[model samples]
Target chain A: EAGVTQSPTHLIKTRGQQATLRCSPISGHTSVYWYQQALGLGLQFLLWYDEGEERNRGNFPPRFSGRQFPNYSSELNVNALELEDSALYLCASSLYRTKVAETQYFGPGTRLLVL
Target chain B: GIQVEQSPPDLILQEGANSTLRCNFSDSVNNLQWFHQNPWGQLINLFYIPSGTKQNGRLSATTVATERYSLLYISSSQTTDSGVYFCAVEQDFGNEKLTFGTGTRLTIIP
Candidate 1:
């Protein structure tokens, strides 16, 4: 089975620009999650989507938002990117309701460098 | 918000050594997992142990949910094991959200 996959392994954006990162969940998986790993902030939860609907979001500002597609794939959008927005954006997926598949499988991650 | 703390924020060990990393959460959780972020930054799921103990290869993890803490062990460590290890948890059953800890940086010298 293919693990979670993310696109644009590396991205470069300038201040005030918008960046979009993509993720494809494992087959049959219905939930996707997004996280940001900054230099000192550690890994902070960004958003959570399930079955095409955003279920929860973290403490990030309104500039950070995302949506899940019908296929369970996800996109994280960071608008008006600031220098501090630079970080490794990670995507993960899991089976919606299962005992063994509850654990999330992560992608290689996208390294976003906001200038 | 639940707070997760990892011990020995930084560690250095020679290859073939055994080491233990600890994770403590401030509250109850429905699930707990361990992940290894390689030098290249790929988050690899190491364990999905919410309770009891589970082992994979020379790596094993035990989560004492009742105590709100978990331990990850690396035996016969290799240079490939050099990376940041993270502990994540779900606040409720069927919850897809995860809060991550600060992480433990491990460096193994060959």
Candidate 2:
């Protein structure tokens, strides 16, 4: 089975521009999550979507948003990007359950650079 | 929010040496995972051991959920093992979102 896949391995944008990153979950997976790994800062959860609905969000600003499709693929949108927004955006997926925790597999991550 | 911490922020070992990495969480977790981040920044899943122990090839991980800690053992480490290892956890049961640790950078010198 294929693991999680991401698009645009690298991206370069200027401040105030918008950036969109995409991720496709592994086969048979139903939950998608986004995380940002900033320089000097560890990975931070961005968003969580399951069954086509947003489930949870981190402490990021409103500019960081994303949605999951019916096929369990997800897209993360960063609007009005800032220099600090430059980071490796990773997406992970896992089987969705209400009570049982499932293992999450990650993608290669999109390296976004905001100038 | 749960905080995850990794010990020995960095380690350097000669090829064929053995190493142990540790992870500690501030609260109970329903999910615990170990990932190896390659130099190119791709996170490769190493283990999904929330409890008990599991081994794959030269790597083995044990998670003691009750103690809120986990240990990853890399036996006879190779130069290929050089990279950053991260431990992530899901604090709330069924909440798939992961909170990652600061990561442990391991360098294996040939």
Among all candidates shown, the one with the greatest TM-score: 2
Q: DockQ for all models, in order?
A: 0.61, 0.83
Q: Write the per-residue lDDT of candidate 1 for residues B1-110, one digit (tens) a residue.
A: 89999998999999999999999999988889999998889999899988999999999999998999999999999999999999998887655688899999999999
Q: lDDT, candidate 1, residue B59?
A: 97
Q: Candidate 2 chain B: worst 10 consecutive residues by lDDT?
A: B89-98
What tens-digit string does per-residue lDDT give for candidate 2 at A2-115?
A: 889999999999999999999999999999999999998889999999999999899899999988888889999999999999999999988988889998888999999999
> Any residue pairs clashing in model 1, and if so which?
none
Error of 2 at B97 (Å): 1.2
After superposition, candidate 1 runs with Cα above 4 Å error: A98-101
Model 2 Cα lDDT, one tens digit per residue, B57-105: 9999999988999999999989999999999998886556899999999
Residue pairs with backbone atoms closer than 3 Å in model 2 (clashes): none
Which interface RMSD does candidate 2 score? 1.1
Q: How many backbone clashes does every candidate have?
A: 0, 0
